[model samples]
Target: MMRIGLILAGGQARRMGGIDKASAILNGRPLIHHVLERLAPQVDQVLISGRSDYGSGLTVLADRTDGPTGPAAGLHAAAKHLADVPDCGLITVPVDAPFLPLDLVERLCAGPLPAIAHAGGRMQPAFSAWTPVEVAAQLAHRPAGAGLALIQLARDANARTVAFENPGAFRNINSAEDLAAAEADVD
Candidate 1:
C-alpha cells in the first residue's frame, strides 16, 4: 500500500502562548521544517493538518466541523483528503515532535494495519500508522461534539503498539522550555 505522511499541526498550543507550534522556531528553523526533513523521505507524500500556511507548499488538511475535534480531527481531515486514493495508508506524527525517528514509517507499517508508536512504556497515538478507511469508519462512530481522543480511537481499532527504543526521538516541543532543550540537544 502507498504510504502518506501527515503532520498533526492543529493543536491550540496554549502552553506555547497560542502560537502555531508548527511555526515555532527551534535551532533557527520552524518546527515543521524539522519534522518534514525527518519524515519526508520515509513516506511517499507529506500533508499538514493545520490551517496556517507554513510556506512549505504542503497540502494543509484543515479540521472539519463534520468530524470529531482535537488531534483525531486532523486524522479525520487526512482520511477525507485521501478518500479517493485506494489501497493507501497514512502515517502521522505531531508537528511539535521535531526529533521523530527516521524509521517511524517503516516500524509502524511493519506491524498491524493500525499501529501506534510506543516508547518509554507510553503510547504515542499521534505517532501512528493507519489504514485510512478503517480510521474513517472508526471516527464516524465517535461523538463529534466532545471530540474523540486519539488514544481512544487507537484502542477502539485495536492498534498494535510498535515499541521503539529511543524515547528522545519522540520528544516534542510544547513550550519555550521544550524548544530550548531541543535547541541545546541539536547544538
Candidate 2:
C-alpha cells in the first residue's frame, strides 16, 4: 500500500512568535528538510500543508475553508487533495517534529490501517496514517478540537497505537531553546 506523506506545517505557531516552524533551523538545515528526508523515503509522495513557501520542492497544499485552523486544516487539505484517489493512506507529520524516527512510516503502517504514532504517553496525531475512506468518513468533518480530535478519532476507530522507544525523537522544536536542544543532539 502506498502512503501519501502530508507534512503538517500549517500551524499558526503562536508559541514560536508566529515564525514558520518549517523554516526554523535544526542541525544547520531547515526543519522541513530534515522531516522531508526522513519521511519522503517511507511514503510514495509528499505534500506540504502550509501557506508559507519553503521552496522544499514538494507540493504545498494551500489552506482552505473546508477545515478549521491549525493541524486539523493540514489533515483536511491532504484528505481533500487525495479525495480522487480511493483507498489512499494518508501519513501526517508535523513540521516542528524534525527528529521523527526513521521507522515512523513503517511502524505506523505496520499497525492497524489508520494507526497513529504514540510516544511519551502522548498521542502524536500529526504522526498518523489514515485511509481515504476513513478520512472522508471521519476526518472530513469540521474540526472542533483540532489535533486532539484526530487522535480521538483514531482511538474511536480502534487504530493501533505504534509506540517508539525514544520519546525525544518526537520533541517539538517550537522555540529557540527547543531548536538549540535539537542542535546539541546533532552536534
Candidate 3:
C-alpha cells in the first residue's frame, strides 16, 4: 500500500499575529521545511494542504470552499484527491509541528485502518493515518450540521488511538512564545 503524507498548513495562524506559520522560521529553517524533512522519508509522496507551495515542490491542495472550514477542509481536499486512487493511505500532520516523531507513519499504521496519535492525554487529530476509501465514505455520509471538525470525524470513524510516549514530540508552534521554546529545544 502506498503511504502519502499531507501537511496541514492552511491555518491563518491567528495566535501568531496572522502570519503564515508554514513560513515561520524555526532553527534557521522554515517550519514547513522541518516538517517535510521529517515526513518525506516516511511516505511515497507528500502533499501540502495550503494556499502556496512554500517552495517545497510538492503538490499544494487548497481547501474546498463548499466544505466546513478549518483543517477539515484541507482533509476534504485530500480525500477528493485520493478518491479514485487504489491501495493508498494518507498520513496527516500539522505544519507547525516541527518535532514530529520520526516513526509516526509506521506507528500509526500499526493500528486500525484509521488511527490517530494519542499523546499528552489527548487525540492529536492532525497526526493521523486514514484509509482513503473509508475517509471518502465518511465524508459522503456526513449529516447536515455535523460541522467540519476533524475530531468529530475521528469519533464518527471510530478511529483507533495509538498511544505515544513522548508528548513533547507533538508540540505545536501556535504563538511566538511557542516558537521560541521550540527553537530552544532544537539542537
Clashing pairs in 3: none
lDDT (0-100) at residue 30 of candidate 3? 95
Model 1: CA > 4 A from native: none
Off by over 4 Å in 2: 140-148
TM-score of 2: 0.89
Output the lDDT of residue 132, model 1: 85
Which candidate ranks first by lDDT, i.e. highest? 1
Looking at model 1, which ten-residue stretch has the lowest summed lDDT?
Answer: 139-148
Writing each residue's lDDT as its tens digit, candidate 2 over 1-187 gives: 7789998887777778877888887877888988888898999999988876488778888766656556666777777888888657789888888778988988888856888888898888778898767766775554644443666677777887888899888888888778877787752
| Cα lDDT listed for each candidate | 0.90, 0.79, 0.89
Task: Evaluate model 3: give its lDDT.
Answer: 0.89
Task: Enumerate clash totals for all models, in the order shown.
Answer: 0, 0, 0
Off by over 4 Å in 3: 143-146
Candidate 3 residue-wise lDDT, 1-187, digit = tens: 8999999999989999998999999989999999999999999999999989998788999877555677877888898888888988899999999999999999988757799899999989999989888877778855433457788888889998899999999999999999988888875
Better of 1 and 3 by lDDT: 1
Model 1, 65-138: lDDT tens digits are 88888999899989998998998889999999988998999999986779999998799989999988988889
